[model samples]
Structures are given as C-alpha cells and as structure tokens.
Target: MQTELSKRLGVEYAVFGFTPFPAVAAAISRAGGLGVLGAVRYTAPDDLARDLDWIEAHADGRPYGLDVVMPAKKVEGATEADVEAMIPEGHRRFVTETLARYGVPELAPGEAAGWRITGWMEQVARSQLDVALDHPIRLLANALGSPPADVIARAHERGVLVAALAGSARHARKHQEAGIDIVVAQGYEAGGHTGDIASMVLTPEVVEAVDPLPVLAAGGIGSGPQVAAAFSLGAQGVWLGSVWLTTTEADLHSPALTRKLLAAGSGDTVRSRALTGKPARQLRTEWTEAWDDADGPGTLPMPLQGLLVAEAVSRIQKYEVDPLLGTPVGQIVGRMNSERSVQAVFDDLTRGFERAVDRVNRIAGRSAR
Candidate 1:
C-alpha cells in the first residue's frame, strides 16, 4: 500500500479520500490515508480558514490536503453582478417550473441558501487557496484543471505539494509542464466534473505522460481490487470521493443518504451540466432530467448554471422530501450500500488489498514453479 507519495505524506496507505466534510477528511487522515477536504463549497475565506483550523486540530498531526475548483476556462472579469446578469429569464423560469412540477417546496422565510454557486470563480478559489496555504496543509489540489502558475508557485514556496486532476494524457502533460507535483487521472465514472475517458485507458496514458511525477488513479476506484488495478496501471495512489459519502463522518443529509441506499445503482447516475455547468456525475434525479430536456432552457456555462440551481438545491435539501434531490457521486456508489465508520472502511480496503496481492502472487508462483 505504500508508495513514494504515501511515504512523503507519512500515511500507511495511498488511499486518498476527498470529501466536503472536514470530519471525514480528518478521519481519513487519522486512519492512515491522506484526507482531502473539498474547499469548493467554502465561499468565504474566513470560513475555510476556520474549518482548516478544525481539521488540523482533529487530524492528530496526520498530513491532509484541500481540493478547490479552478477551471482553466471561465468568463474573465465576470463579477457576481455580471454572472447574475448573464442568467437569462428563460433559464430561471425553467428552474422554477421544474421545482414546482416536482412538488419541491419553497424556502422558508429567513432560511439561508445553504449552497455556493460561484465557487468555480478564480477569485474565490484563489482566496480559499491563499487561506489554506496559511495553514499546515501538506497538499493543494485543483479539481478542474491545472492551477495558475503563480498559485502552483506559491504552494511550492510554502513547501506544499500541488496536485491537479486530469482526464486525459494531454491534460496530464499540461500539469506536468506546469510543475505540478501530482496528477490525479480521473475517469468518466468519477464523481463531479470529469472527462469522457475511462480509467482503464486514462490511467496508463497519464502515467506514461507524467512519468517520474506521481499520478493518482481516480474515478471508479471503490474497493481493494480497484486499488490494486490502479497500482497496476502505474498509479502511485488512488483518489476517492464517492466512496466516502456513505461513511459515518460524511455530512450527507439523512434523506439523501436514504435515497443513496435505496435508489442508487451503478447505472442509476448521469453526467449532466445542470448542477455546475460542467458535466459532473451525480445521482439520476428528476432535477437532472428536467435540465436535460430539450424543451427546457439549455444549461449555462460554468458558474452560471451552478448559480441557477443553487437556491433550488438549497430548497430541496431543506424540505428533504423531494425525490428529485441528488448529490455528486460516482458509479462506485452502487457498492456503497451501507453506512460504516471511517476506520471500518479503511480496514476493508487494507484487507482487500492483501487478498488481491495474495491471489496474484499465488497465480504467479504456480506459473514460476
């Protein structure tokens, strides 16, 4: 389970868990893998700083990382007002109408919209990254594309490793040229924004493209066998997100958790731009279906589409009864049928790795003799 990255990070395994919940991040770090807190949900620098403080305190001195979304392409100089102005009346109407059709209730008076739609903005993501660098974070990861050269430089200046997720060999080469420390080769089955390539093909391509620089295989990796497969593809580690959603430390809502348990299957998810203006894999729901409809207003790009659905999603979450409610998850969700402690999940991964190694070695030994 050890690799150069794991050795550097002082973890027992190279199992990296990426979650929106700090508790989950801290738990994964304590359980001997790198836990990466998804910082895209944090709109304000102060809140992110405060949470990182908490994670540092709870991590028991284990190294952890932060995940931010900074797309390589975005509307430059687009302020909040500018982004808001771009949302057409037709798109707004479609969102409202779709919610009504789903019987989604309205937000109660004075209830805060519990989501951030503009996290993809460069300014906000950089602000969060700046605040993160002030802490003891060992790693900084960009989820969408190669981080700005200055951002990568600043992280390196602070002795932080910079990692970026890549969906293709070309993307991985971009990271490699940009002086990134690691590239997470994520496949189409991964949760959240991903490219069309599958892991089986993408991993080795990225591995060779970014040779000497460590690559983490991501996407559909949810078990020990999957973990072994990642290593076989020359990945130094595995980056997982969806598998952690069902863990006890996850901040998933009870209703959504129940839906994940009862309604989710490997084939029950869809990649749609409705949630974030990028095709992120999430559970198949009426909300996604409505957005995908040709009759509805087509989706916006980047922060705009996310802005359009932010309030609607907040309302759905608050009501907790809408069947249309869903969250970003990967195809591995089908295997995540039970709620378990972070320790239990880690134990399972370790045991699975051992069993897989034993089986492989036995087969090789038979052939050798």
Candidate 2:
C-alpha cells in the first residue's frame, strides 16, 4: 500500500481514514495508516485539544490529523448567533411542525443538546484551528474546500501539510493553484456534502487535473478491491470516512441508528440538502423526506439549514424517534453489516488488496510479484 504520497506523510500505507472518534483515529494510525480526526463536532477548543491529546498518547508515535469545516473567506465578526438569526421564521416553523408530526418531544427544560455542528461558524473554526496547530499534526484538511490563504500559510509555517476535498476537476485545479497539498476526490456517493459525480468518474479526473499532487479517492469505497480500483484510477491514496461509522470504536450513541446502518443497502441512502444547506448523502428516513418534500418550506442554505435542523436532530436521536432518525452516511453502508475493531478492518483490507493483486496477475498470465 506504499505510495509516494503516503511515504511523504511518513505513513506505511496510503489509506487515510477520516473519523470523528479519537479511538478510531488512533487505531488507524497504529494499524499503519493515517487517521484524520473530524473536528467539526467539537464546539469548544478545549474539547478538541483534549481529544488530540488522547489520540497522540494512544497512537504509539504514529502521525494523525484533524478535519475542520472552515470557510474559504475571512469573516472576522460573524458569530454563530448572527448566522442563526439569519434563518427565516418560516424555516423555524417548518422544523417545529416536522418535529411535532414525528411525535418527537422537546428536551427537558434547561437541558440542551450537547452536540451541534460548529465547524461552519468562523469563531469556533478558528479556535479549533488554533488548538490543532498547537499539536504535532501531520496534516490539516478542510472539508469545505481550501482554507483562506492566511490559514494555508499558517499551517505551512507549522510544517503541517494541508488537504482539501474536491468533487470536480475544476475544483481540483483551483485547490492545486491555491497551494493545497492534497485533494480528496469526494463523489456524490459520499456521506457528507458532496458533488454530483461518482468516484469512478471523479477520481481519475481529479488525478489528471492535479497531476503530481496527491489525490485521495473517496465515496462508496470500503474494501481492498475498491482500494485497488482507486489506485488503478491513479489516486495516490484513499480517504475513508463512512467506513468507520459502523466500527466498534464509533460512539454513535444511538443503537437504532447503528442497526439502521447495519441493515441498510446502497439504495437506503439518499442525497438531500436536509442536513446542511448544501446537498449531502445520508440515510433515507422521515427526517430527510420531510425536508425533501415538494410542499415543505424549501431548505435553507449551509449554516442556517444546519441550525434549523440541529435541535430537531438532537430530539430525534435523544428519543430514538424511529421514523425521524437518520444520519449522514455514504452508499458504502451496504457492506458494513458487522461491527469490527479498526485493526480488524485494516487487516481484512490488507488481505483483500493482496488478493486483488494476485487475481490481476493471474489474468495477465504473470506470477504474483
């Protein structure tokens, strides 16, 4: 699994696992792959730093990184409340009505949903970035595209390589031109905010578009054969996020969601702009259907949309409202029927890649190297 990009990052393999759980992230690195922790869920700098501390202590001298949802431009004074206030009353009413229809109850008075996606908020992102840069991180990836020039420069100054997710050749080119160190070609089949193209079509295009720069193939990939396919398409590595959601280390906190994911097929997931203002692939549930409804108040964009649905999601998950419960997941959910340790998954992936190589060699009438 050694690739130029992987070697450049001082990792044994080119597999880059994107996960939110620190345990899972550290496990990936210990298994000889890069584990990029997702930092968007951390609303406080102290919490993020705490997790990074734990990851480093558990990684056994291996490298790790964190992903954040930072906007491309600078917005110094825009607070989360300011962004929340931008959401229209109609959207608020719609969310309230939808929750009521689902029979999801409000949280006990004075009780707050502990988690919210705060990465899009500038203040929170900067705090997260500050905490991340203070660590011994090998990479800092932006999920919302290339970070602002100042952010890129700061990461570079700290000797931290920067990566950004790209969906199209055009976006890849822009990242390359903007000094991005790596490009993760996330396709429409990916879990979170993604583009319209599938990995089969997007990976090679991104690789060709950003020649010499590393491209990590993402979306609908969860196995060794899939990894081989990504390499065959010219990707330097693979970026896996959805694959870890079902792993034992993942703390989804809802058994219902885990059961849904385990039982789901490729078609059980849908791409809807219900989670965020932008279109993202997630599980098909009443929650998604309501936002996707023709007569429903149209979905809000980005931050506003996230705010509009955050509380509803909290309540749904808190009560495990079966019909209204869902999560952002990719098409790869089909093959994730079992919960295994991260090392077990890596071992299977390694074995699978070797088998794929042997099969290809046999087809070419050549002995396995």
Best by TM-score: 2
Over 4 Å off in model 2, which ranges? 73-77
- lDDT of model 2 at residue 299? 94
For model 2 the TM-score comes to: 0.97
| Residue-by-residue lDDT tens digits, candidate 1, 10-63 | 888999999999999999999999999998888889999999999999999999
TM-score per candidate: 0.96, 0.97
Question: For residues 75-179, could you state the per-residue lDDT of candidate 2 as single tens digits?
Answer: 344777777778889889889888888788899999877668677787788899999999999999999877888989999999899999988999889999989
lDDT accuracy of residue 158 in candidate 1: 91
Top-lDDT structure, candidate number: 2
Model 1 clash count equals 0
